[model samples]
Target: MRIPVKHPWTLPKRLLGTFVILASIGRIQSEQKSSKQPNIVVIVADDLGWNDVSFHGADQIPTPNIDALAYNGVILNRHYVLPTCTPSRTAFFTGRYPIRTGMQGKPLSVGEPRGIPLNVRLLPEHLRNLGYRTRLVGKWHVGYYTNEHTPTRRGFESFYGHYSGYISYFNYTISKNNHTGFDLHQDTASTLEMRRNSNYATDVFTEEAVKVIENHDATEPLYLHLAHPAPHSSEAKEVVEVRNMSEVNSRFGYIENINRRKFAGMMMALDQSVGRIVKALGDANMLDNSIIVFMADNGAQTEGFLENYGSNYPLRGLKFTHYDGGVRGVACIYSPLIKNNSRVSEQLLHVTDWLPTFYSLAGGDVNDLGDIDGLDQWSAISLAENSARESLLINIDDAVNLRGVVSGKFKLIEGAADLYGNYYGDTGNNNSYPEYNITEILESDAGLAITSIGNSLLTETKILNLRSASIVRCNNFTDFANCSDTCLFNLQNDPCETTDVSADYPEIFISLSKMIEIFESELVPQTNTDVDPASYPEKFNGFWMPWVASDSSTIIATSSLIGLINILLHIFSLIFFS
Candidate 1:
């Protein structure tokens, strides 16, 4: 103990000790932060309108849990997606435009012969390759006519829901003339048809999601896509009904309209489901560390009469249009990695941008994305200086009349629109609304910017309802290039595409036109354009059979008879031998 204080190595030894302690602490912190990449829980609601949530200034029904999520995270004010379901979902999975995937302006019906396309790698496939357990707990409207096109065959290790845009919450059965069967499924097999139960889809799906979170392997990161079909539609075809009738009176008894009341109840249930999932994560000790993304596939169908009676109020257009109301959605990303919370982001975030973003967060190299449309936005959403994407290639439906793109504050819309805000069919000079210049509509204090879409018998039918207001006619041409109309607007000054700045800014118009041309060139030829869904290939073979029919009692009786006969034969044989 006689070491002198004047020793040469004394100060150096003390500094070395300090450095070692600091290094160990840094390592521990890094380990805790980067344990196994945050679990990605993407909760998508079908047809959730812009003004649907309480945070979006809606007093009809307060989505407190959902509002809490938005307040605790960042509100994606400029988030954009496709006008329809399958198209947006296609863009989400492939990290490419829906036009490229042949789902440009239409959704895959009960038995469309085409889907995500073979040789295409989905978000789940890429994540699964990286040892992530991918689970899809709801709607998969992309495709399902064949076993190969099913969700389980795609990328998800497990899938538990319907293969269509929407389904009945209770009966779980659909009867569309020649196109009818059980919709619920576990993996590829129809669950409702197999087990035959009476459970509301929303509740059953929530329970399944909780199970997925609880039973997840902690060693691997998880990608759970809980897509809820709520406030969308039921078997009644664009008719809204709440699965939980008890909640209707409790949450929205004051709503005078039965349709609106049912919608409010469904929305309440959806909010409760979000809370349940959040709590489940907490129970599993994965809450604080998990990254939850809450968003909708597309805007709600607000412009159609008796069509989902949902409202995207304040936003100009409805579903199946190029209006901000149709494409823009309510979205938020919550995680500890995000530095700024309880704020709004004006950056242009696209649905296609999620694949690369999630992949980047999961420790995958962004360079491996490879020509994918989805840019890695991990840093941007994580409180980085700027988001990875500045502008978005908003909508590109060459098959129709209405389509546009968002660059900075400039938006170029090229098409005609009917009173319903849909450009699908010909308006025929009746109540022809301005698709490009809606400055008054956007600035007005009107209840709804647009009126109800009253289609004839062609309602919710095919896209070929030429006389109906579903299409812009396109010279009634079946070719993709027939949509030659165009309009441009400055969304900054005119949030409604009101002012025809296209004539003023010829350069911008030409630039957007060039981009659209290039994107269209890359688009795959359209498929599943058949007028009748029943005529789609492989319509009957193994798909048309009702897996859980009401007459299944006959099959059970037959099985019992066979069993009795077999037992009698065995006993008689034994007696004869004795």
Candidate 2:
């Protein structure tokens, strides 16, 4: 101690040097992270089915572009989502369980005066804070009752999509409560030009996405949320609009069901859209530094509300039920950064994970997201590490008294007996489905782009391995013959949820039941309000818009006064400087 006191200046200098070295290391790390920030592109397919993409062993449909990406990327075999669109999207955007936001019920109707609460920051907002340019194209069914609820207000710099749950592909019309109106908009303003042009929504969204990529300042990271309206039937639940009917008829002639045939065509456009998006990224020189996440918002609506004629064949239940078919989605991630490629990941994941996952990937701390249901799964996803998730709160719909939870390999569901809790299967064998020319698809503009940046060549063996690993076979257990209200199933043994194991595994069932009770205690009351007539699109130029109005005239007056003051200040500055 006496020796150090005799050399006080030297000790202080040593401490200062240490501090500088630490700061330098931190700065270097920050710079390295900043340089490695990948452009994030999340492509969400609306109402796509589990057995829809060819990679998932479906012969009825050929998603070549989608398959190319899946084969080149990691297929998320056990990716789970909420049962329907809004709830799934809410989880994706908010990083919280829908139950926390009181959005665990049905999709938001046209005029509900509620949305993902504004106080809670959204994914785009967090990304924007980290210097990413965020844009949204396609469906924005989260909320739009107030001016503050739209995408642009929430964080998206540009919003080119519909505000309602679903809209017509060509006409951009949405109908609800016997009121039909235009639903397309370009950041709060009705995209009347698009309506007049009558472009297919998928094609339109693709073009806009391409434009966003092409026109982007590449120095800045991009977060493009391409939420397609394809395959999600229009509100009419009968219309399936595609760019070319002749091509649809020729390409999907083998499909027996007419509705499914239309859906196939719709999916064709969506697949092509994916191709073009990949091509655009390549053209823009962003593919090598990009992460493309392709996922269906939820399982298909094969026969329920907004029935798109999509099939979740070989899985139990459809969109609104608690079964795997309802929540298990078709999802995959393609990126040059993924250390694990051309494989199937059995690790359990949920829709809510995207927020923290993407945020972490963008070099932000997941802890900043704070107490959300989502776990930072970036490492688990990219490095093939085990997922941080131990369990999934599939949903807790208090309004319907339905609750579901998945822990380990067992899943428990209560209040879903009357729902479509039956296993469904397609006749096509997983081992033997109609094969496409891999060379032809892999050589296409999109295929080449995706393959160049992803796992080298898409060989037959790789394709076979991907298919073999991802194929869900329900040969042994064909159906959930009679599921009780509180049914439990070992999903690992019976992925299709064929047998109710609640009585057999009483301990596991009771443990999951208790977990559900704990979640139920934290349930936020569902804010299901009746349609506010004032929000009718008829009042605001035939577009589904923010009808709450929010004192526009007062805002305009204040803005004008502020502009006048700014001009005066500028004049004064000029005089003073001169």
Candidate 3:
């Protein structure tokens, strides 16, 4: 076929059009190339509470460094997570709801064979495929049974932490199954349990985190999970004692109550850890190009079996309960990509949202994470816009004991029993105190003075160096002693979730309760136990048992059995040869 002849002037016009199209394409390419490859460092505080941070109206305990990070970042005022450690972590790492992975309910004992399902891909695994280095520097509570469930086997390039929930900070031991043994591990295998260590768990984890930052490969991006288990004391101890006793006492004498004093010391040490990590990143000249995300794994654990003595004051409930106090937590994100460095984002977000958020921020498509429950909230977080997530399944227990749902400002929760089918949740710590808006205080002279105690910059310049969240100021919610049936509360008005308005909002209750039934339908049967040992050699579990207090008997029995086996084998061999 022959082309039709064009006018002589058409050639020039066509060339100009071609050049413009190419120029536009070149511009698009340039923008894509210039997109920042931020070094991501996610810092998680175990069982941290809303009122624990000094920036959030807690005057007795100071969290200067954490406040500084919150000031220089987007404060997420409506963040929520699971009611327990492993479920929260599983959600965060997998971008899927913990119930989907059968990780819902309580945390695993150190000796439990259960772990985060091996089939589900983790956030680090996704990042590792994208030319990033991944590391874990604290608790790995999801699972640690056979070698398959260890952190090294999961996707972490390097893991310098314990395999259990919370171990003795100094002794690095966990008490379980009527037995206590070493719990700390350097990589995957347990390190020599010397009974005592010169280093505390918090300090050791901080040191490892600093080293990860300092030794990061500049050419490649990084994704570090600095999961510090602080303000989380050992349930093994009746009276909680703060680590680094002399140092804590020297720095914090203002706190009068010894329990409060000990708790404050733990918080301060964690705060110091944040400062040290930030300093290390700054020293490495990666601060400006870094995306720092700080959050609590769950809400305050409170003075339950753990005696954490944490304050989720102004918020009702505590860890292991399907209530606001147990789910809502402290969270913030800081990066140059964010439009405003100091704004409180009221956008609703979930702990599960982080996997998608971080992957998207690192230039990965979240759509590839098939059938995930987390939504990509990058723009909502970085630009302070409305989050894509409007509703969430806070807790959908497979056991059908406790369940919760959030749609807009309305949240409905009911606790007939805990995950174990025991009647739980009769909230008593009613915080009738008025709201102390620290953000407003920062904008005033009085706030400048209050903020000066922890931040030296505020003292020198009479300016609040920290950023304040933009939440409404009002009185705290009223008291509700019990949550009968489905308790309903408008989170915006009664954020502490102290009132049970289920009687008035029957229609709203019906609507949200319907959602719970639908979600519950999709849940798998709860497996509160572990895989059987018949699948693996008995010798594989020759290590610590959660119930065993010591390894001496186990070692003696194991050796005696091994010798007997050897003698039997020799005799059998002689008989067969004869």
Candidate 4:
């Protein structure tokens, strides 16, 4: 290849060097453009226990995908939400207290018209205004029975899935068809039906989710809400494919063998769903730019028919109770933006925080939205910083009577009458005489049946008495006098809620009680003004909707200006350097 060496011009060599430098600059500018916006995906699991995932010490189930997320991102150890599904979801959606939005207790059945207020802007609505294509796949339980509460009405551009409290995993049902049963829907169109087969519900939800990801527009950033309803029902199919077999037997003694197996199966399917979503995003080359959030709506189901199988042990109480087990949940955020993969304890975050956090991460205007009760934790995500709220107040009752306040490690649970009315010897009929003498029964009980009955009664009484003693005057509102015990505990030392430190720390108890009183007095409505008029048909807005700003023009203008500057700089640099 020894060819003739003509005095090849130094001008060409200089031009080549300039081209190389210009290409390098252009590549850097492209990298900057990609970093401006990131995709977001929030995966919400229904009724998953704190210990159910492998990262949280569930040996009986192999949630490797979920564990991988924790290994790569921040695992929040002190994440909390309301005790039930609807309240937690409402908070997550609106960044406001569930009580503030008037969605408490169980979510409304399908066709019910209640929804997040028009005045309160939802997370997706704000994100959508900022130019994100929002989609919700899976459970939309916020307002199932009402058209006003549908996903499209709540800010989602497209909605897929059912509208009901609970549907069969094999034979899923929709509330729109009177709950008898119908195929899942995408908007108003029927998608699929498992009429004669037992296809797992989680599988169906996951499959549809992948489709949504696959079909998403590549140019516009995507915000997908995959709210899976699985591992939540009493009859949910359990997977028995665990590394540790004995762990299942020891941990889930209350659930029957069959149900436990079914639960395990459901969990396995859920793990697979997570894996699938991750794999799909990776295949699409979107994994590095996407933020994946995994969280349960609340603690495991602790009552009704599913009590035995769903245990929140090591944490007292269950789904409906205002206890750690009911409110505390497993939460984690996976993002390339987060540099460290470690457990974040001490930070007290709630469901409401998701809205502002996601908004800030997506580059949305936080202040343009209405009043929100959450703080943006984007700084905490990128850096190992503690960004949490000062306090979390829970109003489990409409009257603000049954409530709890958690500040730091101190949790003040207001002792109110057991709404379940599980008091021993007190027949639900107040007129009936007490069936058994409380003293004689406690002394005589030794067998499993007697011990169980006695323990139940004692627990109920303790909760009742604690409520009564804490209040100076017992109003029939919460029926504090009917409760057997009122108590306070330093949750820091007693995470299990075993020891009552109320007597030892009377001052702490008094302070918490006074705080509760102040919160109740300020927030709880003394008159009918608290009642939401939207619940009534007469208060309909007559098709009125918010004036959503069209941001595409601004986005196009900004992007075009950036591209033009990059191009012009490259051209000028090449010409001058050459």
Q: Best lDDT goes to which candidate? A: 2
Best-to-worst order by TM-score is 2, 3, 1, 4
Cα lDDT tens digits, model 1, 1-578, are 01112233444687656545544554343344345678899999998887676555445665656655555566777789888888889899989887676678677766455677644668887676454789999888887654656777677989988777777777665555455566677886543254366677788899999999999876567889999987677766436767667767765666766777777788878877887787677667676667889998888775463267677765656777777778888787766557765466767789999999888787666676567888887767767447677666766666664567778878776774654553221111212211221222122211011111111111112211211221111122222222235667666666644446677898988988887777767877666554345433244433332122223344334433443343333334323432
Q: Residue 114 CA error for candidate 3 (Å)?
A: 1.0
Please provide, for model 4 over 1-578, each residue's C-alpha lDDT reduced to its tens digit, 9 standing for 90 to 100. 01111232433798657656766765454344434668899898887776566555334444656755554566776788887777888889888877676675454543344555544557776666445789998887665333334577566888877655556566564323222444355764443343444566788778888888898766667899999876677232432233234654554433444555446666767877887787677656667677889998877764563342444544555676676767788788877667643444446788888898887776555674457788887776667677668677765465535778777767777754354222111001122212222233223211112232221223335423322322112112122122324556566666655555677888877888887777666552322222223332122221111112324444334434443344445445334542
lDDT of each: 0.65, 0.81, 0.69, 0.59
TM-score to native of every candidate shown: 0.75, 0.88, 0.78, 0.69
* Candidate 2 lowest-lDDT run of ten: 1-10
Q: Write the per-residue lDDT of candidate 3 for residues 14-90, one digit (tens) a residue.
A: 76565455545543443443335678999999888777776664566667677667765667888999988888998
Candidate 2, lDDT over the whole model: 0.81
Model 3: residue 501 alpha-carbon error in angstroms: 2.4
Which tens-of-lDDT digit does each residue in 330-359 have in candidate 2? 999988888878889999999999999898
Kindly provide the TM-score of model 4 when superposed on the true structure, using C-alpha atoms: 0.69
Q: Tell me the spans in candidate 4 whose CA falls farther than 4 Å from its real position.
A: 1-35, 144-146, 174-179, 191-198, 234-256, 302-308, 399-401, 416-485, 522-578
Candidate 2, residue 304: the lDDT equals 55
Best by TM-score: 2
Question: Is candidate 1 or 2 superior in TM-score?
Answer: 2
